[model samples]
Target chain A: MKRVGIKDVAREAGVSPTTVSLVLNGQSARIPDTTRDRVRRVATEIGYAPNSVARSLRTQRTHTIALISDRIATTPFAVEMVQAAQDVAREHGYLLLLVNTDGDHDVEREAVDALLSRQVDGMVYACMWSQVVDVPAGLPAGTVFLDGRPAGGGFPAVMPDDRAGAMAAVQELVDQGHTRIAYIDAGEEPVPIASRLRHEGYLEVLRRAGIEPDPSLRVEASITTAAGGVAAAGELLDRPPAQRPTAIFCFNDRVAMGAYRAARHRGLEIPTDLSVVGYDDQQFIAAELDPPLTTVALPHYEMGRWAMQVRLGVLAAPTENDGVHLMPCPLIRRESVAPPPAQHPAPAGDGE
Target chain B: MKRVGIKDVAREAGVSPTTVSLVLNGQSARIPDTTRDRVRRVATEIGYAPNSVARSLRTQRTHTIALISDRIATTPFAVEMVQAAQDVAREHGYLLLLVNTDGDHDVEREAVDALLSRQVDGMVYACMWSQVVDVPAGLPAGTVFLDGRPAGGGFPAVMPDDRAGAMAAVQELVDQGHTRIAYIDAGEEPVPIASRLRHEGYLEVLRRAGIEPDPSLRVEASITTAAGGVAAAGELLDRPPAQRPTAIFCFNDRVAMGAYRAARHRGLEIPTDLSVVGYDDQQFIAAELDPPLTTVALPHYEMGRWAMQVRLGVLAAPTENDGVHLMPCPLIRRESVAPPPAQHPAPAGDGE
Candidate 1:
């Protein structure tokens, strides 16, 4: 069978090939509605598949955006961001091309060159975790960053408001009438921006509540995983009844899971005996805990949507001085928080 | 400055535009190496970016493939498959375009039409979970399925060997001196192929060991999540000490997590009082458990690579008669498995 081309559609529709092209390429606003309909109907009747590749060469608009990320598609973290970007892009008749670099610079360069070779209209550079990243060279002029900011601070970035999220988490604990609060900070030297901002939020809340931050109550987890949570929370939980914190704020949901285990090991019932709050509201881990978990949501989906909008010009592009968009991180209330216990129990045997 | 084109490179290299196009498009095999290197050097020196869209229109080879998946890119499950497919495609000098349909049929049709319009050389149709899916209409011929088989059974498919994976999980328990074992199956009504195959593996292993399959031991989880596992495993663990199984083979990692909690509530330490094995070594949930879970890994990454290889003709395409490729699922040994206890303790208070 012979493939139908634009010339065939033009001959059948009794119009110039350029006219047929304009009607099919969605640039037919000036063309009468009847002519547009006739061209489309004839093309459909003759089985003519409009070739975007050919149209793109003439118009310099492929209507395709490339999303290059370090590990968003492969890792379990922040997958919603990709979905949200795809959703917005689809609505605008633009296809999204995904490329995961696996955190390799060479792979990233290759991916950028490939997208540029195809003349993608725009690019979305995303990161799995919220951090400052060095924007690779050769990216197009209007590249938008998701969940991260450029180290040189020129590109537009959409990131979760970590400090505000932390304040919300701690405020919930304070609202529950808990004064003795402990914080399990994550990461070591050169801590991530999220960790630093979250810690600052925690202290700000304590200060506003007229409560002095206790040195012993502030502990650092070796990492942000559940294992780290257990060790950090265990130290605070092992303290005498009078000295132990009544509530704990963890770095992330994984660490909160550790707090759950630590509390379980010490025979402490959540909320009743101790209250806990976590950050990043990670899927499965947060909602699947025994008492469920009260935590801060990272706004990944919203960030994705915002970045796509910026890239596509649906939203105004951020200026050079105001390029970073700090999306709000809302508090998700679950069953993990309540008023402090009436009285504390005596110290129990230390359990690993 | 004006944009550089093939004409500029041709003029600079003292060659015709045809020669410039042939060399830059990787079709310089018939040309002398000296001319080919000279053309490429001139093209690079002048910063002439090859317009692939224009080249594709003339040659009908876009060097691009589309991966249209039902939730694979958005969801955490089977994400490695996308990564693997991208890696293989990138190695072959092909860019992979990703479109997630979000399980909507209309959305899928639009995605397919969009890809076809763009003239992708081929497509990989992927599903987040292994199952028989109805191939959406309008997908071009030679489309390959990953982690799923077409319901009509014509397209080539790459899927995990769920039956063999279950066998490995159960065989491990049998080798570890566990006589009495229980299974927590998932999903109801239209049970997924994985559930049925895994059950068969369990029964087959038990029969070969000459152990009678206990009807009470084979229970069903209302859902595959941790909450469902708690309810299902709680029922089994609530049985009399003499009647309880020493090991529990959960449907997946989430269910295994529930079994852990159920055992803790019953004062049964993992592996010491009860042994547990899970399937789908899901990221975070499997490795981040209290004692890392022993589970079977779904061959998602391998399946992705295989499907891409078939699509790109790197491997022999599956014939209609042998279109389904079953990749093996290997057992990841962790701390969750051990020998059964020496003696059963007397029935203690029933714990939820």
Candidate 2:
């Protein structure tokens, strides 16, 4: 029993192999519907099945994209980048391949080799945490960076607007009529590159508001955890009531939680006692916390969608403007912000 | 200019195409070292760059696996499943393709068709939340389900051991001398299928301990959120002090947080007033919850790695395993659970 070939179908349908190929591949718009129907019926009657491998070789298009990342699956919320990119790729009739390199350069090289060997049309390089990354060798056209900027400056990058986000968060606090705002930062290393951008934004907004910079108000967290927030907040609040800032801007949501804990420890109620704002609206932390949290939203999903679009655009026609593309980080207002108290008071309520 | 082909290199090196191919592909074990070195030198002199697509065609292996998931990116914490699987796939020299269908049957169908057409070697079908799923049509050889069970038999699956986890949690509570233990459950929808299994485990443990189950001690909350924990806990503690259960097991960590809030609202301290245990370690939630939560680790990462291994195994040689593969769910001991209080007292302390 021999597999029926396309030529056999063409002969049976009284048409050329190209006509049969067009009809079978679903690219038969130019061909007549009646002829296509006849060709399809003939192919079905002859049991003709197109070979996938042969088709790929002939078409030179796999309709696939590789998503190279440093451990997206392990990161809790950052999976949104992959999810959104996959959705966009599916819409464009492309499959999104995920390669988690585990921060091992060798594994990443193997992944790129495998994907390239399979002839993926494009790729989107993403990072679990936003940072500056070294561009991989053999990066073809249509490759875009998501959440990480390329250090070499050839690849286009799509990232969170961290500076603008911090500025907006501080501006929101100021709009609520609070002036004395302190900045809690993750000390160094391991902290995302966007953290520095956010710190810059915090200072820029503070200067614009004419609040003189106070080095005493800025506390660096050694471990970059909620414990850091607690210690930093404690440092600021332990000072004389008159000298203390009315509000605090945390680098991220986890630090904000620490600040919340610190405020509670000092018998200060959120908003009513200390207006608090956080970044990266991590849903579990922000919504689940008591009184909820007002924070900055990282546009992870949208950035993914935009990155895919940019990749597709590069595939269509190469463009210049290798500059960074910054997506907005919107402010998510909850119940955590309020005007500063007239005077810090002694505990009116007992332990909560 | 004509591309430098393997045949050209072979001609220049005075060797057959097979000898040249073996040397260039790093498979020169059978050939002499001198011959290998000569072929390599000639290939390099000619600037021979192997065409990846042609190599794939000759090899007949894509070294790719597809992960068909139901909204993994949207669901928080479940990304660990992807991360672990991706790492495993990378270890095996396979690129993992992600297809997030968002529960759309059409998109899922398209994903299957596209992956099949692109000749992916295997697939790992996963769900963001654990549940029973219908096997997709036209599932080829070398496929496994992750964090979900195929409704029909004849497929391998890897999932968290929910029953054993619950039993272990209950056993831990019993070991600490708490008899009047209660169970709080999420009402109906969105309550993971594992919840029912956990409930069964709880009952099994209680029966083993010679403790008769109390129906009134079981309170089903409306939503699966922290608010649900609060309401259910409030219902349990609203009764007379003599009749109240000493220990309560909330369905999940979020609910446990609610229970924490409820205990605080009632001026009851965790462990001293109420011993709380949660499920799904949910690092962000469980670890950050002030006293932290003593909960069950869902084994999401392990489950993912196991699923990928199963997929690779299937690709190697398919095996039949109709039964569910229940991975261990370890207990993470935190400060949340403690021995039942000696006596239930009325509100005494103002706060902490």
Candidate 3:
């Protein structure tokens, strides 16, 4: 079948092609609403589709974005962020071309080169985990970061407020009348710095409760994996029964999963014996756990929207700003965390 | 710095621009090997990148593939299939544009229209599960199906060999001497025909071993989720002792996880107490379990490669073939299954 054109819609609607184009483009402010409606109805009847490639060539705008990531396309839950970005881009008549770099600098360079060749109008960089890394030098004019910021500086980054998320989680435990909460950090070589931010949040909350943060109560996780969470809990569990912290805050959900394993290994029941709180609120891990996981959730979908907006703005106006936008990390309450044991006094802590 | 162009590469290499172009495009067969190497080296050294968009317009080939997925991008391990496709596409100088439809016909139509407008050369439609779904009508001619087949066939499709995978798993159980093996199917409302295929493989293997498949031992999982798995195992475990099957073959990994939970709830240890086998080989669920899991792994990475090859093949030569290719699903032996109890006799039945 011959492809339908705007001319067909115009001829059928008894209108000029210019009027048909204006109506189809939603730029029918001068045209009467009735005319616009009729033109649209006729276009649908005739299957009129504006030749997008032809339009792109004329306008010098591909309306396509390149989302280059280490593994966002493969990582669990992280892909949701990409999907959210796709949804936003689609709303704005743009499609996303994702290039998985696999953390190889050479692969990243090739991916960028390939996307540039395809004429992607803008670019977004995503990392599975929030981390501080050097922005690729000489990026296209319109580039944005997701879940990370340039260790050095370049574009606007939308990262989860890990400090706020950790504070909210610890505060949840505090509200349940538990004062002695343990902080499980992402160890010494914390890549993202969220581990330190979250640790600081925990300390600040303890100080707010008028309990001096105990150095001994603070422990570092080996890595952000489940094994790390398990090891971090092992140290705290080693302490005498009454002396151990009543509750623990993990750096991420995987760490919390590790804590669950450690607790189960040591015959410790969750919530009943120990109140646990985690971050990242990874649905697959959080929802599938035994009692479910009460954790802090990052606004990945919103973050995606914000990143797309940043790229869109940069494309519209070539402006540069060294901005770090920390999106809110909301607290998701489930069954994992609860009040510490009844016999333990309110604000239980070491005899300082 | 100003962008380097073909003219610059020719000048830098002391060769004609035609020679540089030919070398860059791999049309350097007529050129001397040493001259070709020098031109390529000069191109890389001077950072000469061909104007891809202009070239695409000239060649009428975008060298871009659209990966339209229902939920593969949002799924856990299934996203790896996309990554595999991306890796293969990248090697062949193609970038992938991923659009998630979530099984909505409207969204699928929009995604296809948008991609067609962007001049994507081909498309691969992927679904998280292997099911027979209605192929969206009027899809671009260069399209292939992944993990699913068109209800009414036209294009090429690649699906997991679930029957072969199931037979292999059951045979492993049988080799270790299991006759009364239970089949926890995906139920009669199975969206993916793989469930039934796997169940059939199990029965066929049992019959081959001269064992009549027990009707009571066969149960169907309500859903493929972990909860569905747990429920399916619950019904099987409800039977009186000595009547229960010596081993169980779950529909998928999540179902196997459920069987693990049910076994634990009933004080039965995996392999030692009741040998359990699962399908899908989901890393998170399979690896993290107490004893790990022995399961059949769908060759998702291979399936992706197959889908990409099909699309590329169609683009190379517009040939028509109503083909459904079933890729191998290899067995990944972990710790979930083992020899049946020594006390049990050969061909152990309900009479035991």
Best by TM-score: 1
Fill in the DockQ of model 3: 0.46
TM-score of chain A, every prediction, order shown = 0.92, 0.89, 0.82
Candidate 1, residues A146-264, lDDT tens digits: the string is 98888888788898999999999999999998999999998683448888899899999999999998978889989878899999999999988878999999998988999998999
Query: Model 2, residue A4: displacement in angstroms?
Result: 7.3
Per-residue lDDT of A198-312 in model 3, one digit per residue for the tens? 8878888888888877888888887877777888898898789766888888887888888887887787889888889888887667776776899998788888888887787
Ranked by lDDT from best down, the candidates are: 1, 2, 3
Flag regions of model 1 displaced more than 4 Å: A13-15, A22-38, A189-191, A344-352, B22-39, B189-191, B344-352
Point out where model 2 deviates above 4 Å.
Answer: A1-16, A25-33, A42-52, A314-322, A344-352, B1-4, B22-33, B44-52, B55-59, B314-321, B344-352
Clashing pairs in 2: A73-B83, A350-B351, A351-B351, A351-B352
Candidate 1 lDDT by residue in tens digits, B211-232: 8999899999998888999999
Compared with the true structure, what per-residue lDDT tens digits does model 3 show for residues B68-141? Answer: 99874446677877888888898898899988887899988888888776678889999888988887865976
Runs in model 3 deviating more than 4 A are A1-51, A188-191, A314-322, A343-352, B1-49, B187-190, B314-322, B342-352
Compute DockQ for each candidate against the true complex.
Answer: 0.64, 0.54, 0.46
| Cα misplacement distance, residue A317 of candidate 2 (Å) | 10
